[model samples]
Target: MPKKRVQVVLNEDIRKLGNNGDLVEVAPGYARNYLIPQHKAVFATPGVLKQVERRRQAEQRRLEAQRQEAIAFKDSLETIHRFRIERQVGEGEAIFGTVTNQDVAEAIQEQTGREVDRRGISLPDEINKIGFYKAHVKLHSDITAEIEIQVAPS
Candidate 1:
């Protein structure tokens, strides 16, 4: 006689098997003795599959909404186009300190009333002198906004 297999939905990740919420087939003995008793997985029933499908759909909807918001924000940033940062001049248009991502984020918020995460902004090079530079701001996985930054002495 052949050994019977059981279908189960994992409550947590199992090595070499599947991740949480994944449906997998395993030996009946393993499912009944170890997985069920240890609360690591449950039998994959019709109700369980339906619940998982619903949760997946909800998550997709939420992600789509966030992407839409990022698109709108990107449009707003494009309209603004440029932001200015004022710093103390030392000599020959060179500022006392280098411009940081936090400074650029603050400048954007001050000028446009929009909040941007500092970690997402990437500067081309060090900004030590008063001049025009470009920055790339990653708003979403697929969306990036380029804003011109003007550094002027205060």
Candidate 2:
């Protein structure tokens, strides 16, 4: 049997739970296909795991500390004021204009000093007329924000 140094993906939070020099049991197929290709994990030897335990502990602590920092920032982000976009209403009880994704992104950047890409802003539907609307900002996979825009007569 040929022993191979293989990288494996753990079910745990690999960022905090493992170190480069630590050996973890992973599926041979997974090690050969995924982890090695993505560079997300590394191969380690059995003897090295014991030595890298300390490094793993440090990484967990650091990951926790950084998580706390991110939480703090996220809380502050909730306080970010929403930018109100006012537009003119026209015939058929609709806005006399089309509000585009670029408009939404620019509004956020103008108000929050955050340069949000328009592609990340999701509108429920096309804004073809005058009305109050909600726009979505996908800040992260789990975190999102709704922005309110008011359309009025110009």
Candidate 3:
């Protein structure tokens, strides 16, 4: 029988994950030749296993700091700017057409000077009605943003 050790980088935040971190079980050859060499992480030796505690703590602190900063930045933005869109409407108050990500990107660019990706700017599955809406901007895997959109007669 053969036994080996390996370390896994937490793709998601580690705070929620238990202290027993997810260690990618792999052949020692692959762990040494590929994963560890790539800096993906280290082999779970006694010393490295000891680091999980510190590393998790450090990651948690960093995540919290980043979250706080994002909140503060979002608050500041709320006071100064909001992303808005304009569209043509029909007599019945229904939007004549639709609003796509490009429209939202351009609106954000024009309003806030922030170049957001259309893919990153998510609209309703189908935004055909004339009204205000909210779009989620995936700032990070763990962080997201919402922007106010105003649809009016174009």
**Candidates' RMSD to native:** 2.1, 7.1, 6.6
- By TM-score, the candidates rank as 1, 2, 3
Candidate 1 lDDT over 24-48, as tens digits, reads 9999999999999999999999999
Quote the positional error of residue 130 for candidate 2 in Å. 1.9
Please give the lDDT score for candidate 2.
Answer: 0.65
Residues 29-140 of candidate 2: C-alpha lDDT, one tens digit per residue: 7777877677755556554455567777898899777666545434544566345567776678676568888887787777767666678778868777777777777665
Q: Candidate 3 residues 51-132, lDDT tens each?
A: 7678879989998887887676455445544566777777778786688889887876676676656887788787787777
Q: Where in model 3 is the C-alpha error above 4 Å?
A: 1-73, 80-82
* Highest TM-score scorer: 1
Off by over 4 Å in 1: 1-3, 13-16
What is the C-alpha local distance difference test score of each model? 0.92, 0.65, 0.67
Q: Considering summed lDDT, which 10 consecutive residues are worst modelled in model 2?
A: 4-13
In model 2, the Cα lDDT at residue 139 comes to 62
lDDT for 8 in candidate 3 is 57
- Model 3 TM-score, all chains together: 0.51
> How high is the lDDT of residue 41 in model 2?
57
State each candidate's clash count: 0, 6, 0
The alpha-carbon deviation from the true structure for residue 36 of candidate 3, after best TM-score superposition, in angstroms, is 16
Please give each candidate's TM-score: 0.86, 0.52, 0.51
